[model samples]
Target: MIPPRSNRSQPLACNILRYRDLNRIERMFNRLKLFRRIATRYDKMAKSFLGFLHLTAAKLWLPGFVKRG
Candidate 1:
């Protein structure tokens, strides 16, 4: 076992960049849950369920990459 440091004077620093990324990921999950099928998990098979999930995620992600004509 490693010994703990005795001189703990300052509070721990948070990584702002990592926290921002985590927040973005959490928000994306919240958005995904807005879809009824995904929230209910209607598919019984793992392969089909995963495929549907990928399609749903792509549907959410594609608009950002695609431009409106």
Candidate 2:
């Protein structure tokens, strides 16, 4: 996977197909469709909504991405 390039208009969006370090892969998850689902969620508390959304995204995505990773 490519590292972030700060000079761009936006941070690079990509999934890490392979990585020597797992932590490095974690940093790239935002480019993934799963984690991005948080944007659509609604909850009584803003923090509650965002936290659960992230958890759901991780639960759904981690299995799929981890397998490919």
Candidate 3:
């Protein structure tokens, strides 16, 4: 007995927008690196470094609210 062949003509569905999201995230990290404290190993303690990272991220996020207001 021979097996039936499946349709090969249909194109695979893809999410192109995911790549755009990834690109935006990459850009955000690149922007984050622009800050001297985050870019360099200035903070010796991990807790202090993480706190500064969150502060930097908040600074980056605050502009959107400023624009809306």
RMSD of each: 6.9, 9.9, 9.3
Ranking by TM-score: 1, 3, 2
Better of 2 and 3 by TM-score: 3
Better model by TM-score: candidate 1 vs candidate 2:
1
lDDT winner, 1 or 3: 1
TM-score top scorer: 1
Candidate 3 colliding pairs: none
Model 1 residue 61 lDDT score:
95
- Can you write out model 2's per-residue Cα lDDT over 1-69, one digit (the tens) per residue? 666777878887766555436655575554443443454554668898768766775675677656553
Shift of residue 26 alpha carbon in model 2, Å: 22
Considering every candidate listed, which one attains the maximal lDDT?
1
For each of the candidates, give the backbone clash count.
0, 0, 0
lDDT accuracy of residue 37 in candidate 1: 82
Model 3 segments beyond 4 Å from truth? 1-14
Name the better of 2 and 3 by lDDT: 3
lDDT of 1 by residue, 1-69 (tens): 223345767646666677788889899999989988889999889898889889999999999999899
By lDDT, the candidates rank as 1, 3, 2
